[model samples]
Target: MKNITILLILLTLTFSNVSAQKIKDGETVSLNGLSVTFNITNKESVTVGGKNFDRYKVSANLVNNSEKSFNIRLNASPQVASNTNLVELDCINATGAKLTSKKMELKLKAHNLNATYWYYNKEGKYVSGVLPVIAGYYLDPGDSVNNNAIFIVPQGETPDVLLRKI
Candidate 1:
C-alpha cells in the first residue's frame, strides 16, 4: 500500500512537469491542454516622444489541443514569482554562451526602452503596459489565436527568447 501511494505521487509530479514546459523561440509547448508558442516575426521600430526605439516583434500563438475548451490567462508577468528577473522573457544571444539550464537567472538591470504585450496605442503603437490584458484570451476546442508583443534590446544583437511559462 505504501509503495503504491509513493508511485502514484511520483507519477502525478511527472505529469505536471510535462504539461508546464519551458518554451523557446519557434518551439511549441503544452500548458493546460493548449499548444502555445512565441515566435519573433521581425524587428521593428516604434516612435515615441519624438524618438524612435527599435523593438523585437514577437507573435504568441495558442491552440486548444484537448478535447474540451478552456480559458487561460497568459503568465505575462512571470517574473513576479519567487524568482525575479530583469526582463519578462529571458533574452539571450543566439550563441547561448554560458548557458546552464533552460531557464536563466535574470539580474536586476536595465538597458533600453521597451514594451510588453499589455498596453499600447496607435501613435506609440505600444503594448507595453501591464497587459490589463495579456489580451484576455479564452478559446473553445480546436480554436487558436495569434497575439503580438514587442521587446527592445541593444542594437546588433538578436534575442533568443525563452519563456518558462505562458
Candidate 2:
C-alpha cells in the first residue's frame, strides 16, 4: 500500500508539471531579447449566420524587462488557408458586439505579411499600433471570424513583440 501511494504521487506530480508547461493564461514565452507574456481572457464559443465558431479575446503586453529600448513588430497568420472562415471581431463600448454590415477579415498571403510597429521608449514606456488584417470586419458588426493571430518575434538584441493566437 505504501509503495503504491508513493508511485501515484510521483506520477501525479510529473503529469502536472508537463501539463503546466502547455500554454495557459499568464504564461510567458521568450523571444529575441524580450519576454513575451500572453494573457488570454473571455474565451467563449458562439454561433453566427448559422455557423458555430470559437472566439477568443486576447491582450498581449511586450515588456522590455531588459536594459535597452527596442523596436518590435507584431504579426499573425491564419493556421488554415481558407479566407471565408477567418474573421476578426470589433468591440463596441464595454460589451462585445459584432459590428454589422461591414465585413472584417484578416488577409494573409504567402508573399505579403501583416505587421504592426511598437516603440519602447526610454523609461520602459510602450507604444503600440495596429495592422488591420481584415478590412471589412468591425466590432459592432454582426459577424465573427474563425481565425487567430500569429505573432513573429525576430532575432535581435532589442526587445521584440511577436504575434499570438488568442
Report the Cα lDDT for residue 128, model 2: 78
* Alpha carbon lDDT at 158, candidate 1: 53
**For every model shown, what is its TM-score relative to the native structure?**
0.40, 0.30
* Predicted structure with the largest lDDT when compared to the true one: 1
> lDDT (CA) for every model shown?
0.52, 0.37
Give lDDT tens digits, candidate 1, residues 39-149: 778876545445554566666676777788444433554323332222234555332222222233322222222344555587766555633323223456777766555
Error of 1 at 136 (Å): 11
In lDDT terms, how accurate is model 1? 0.52
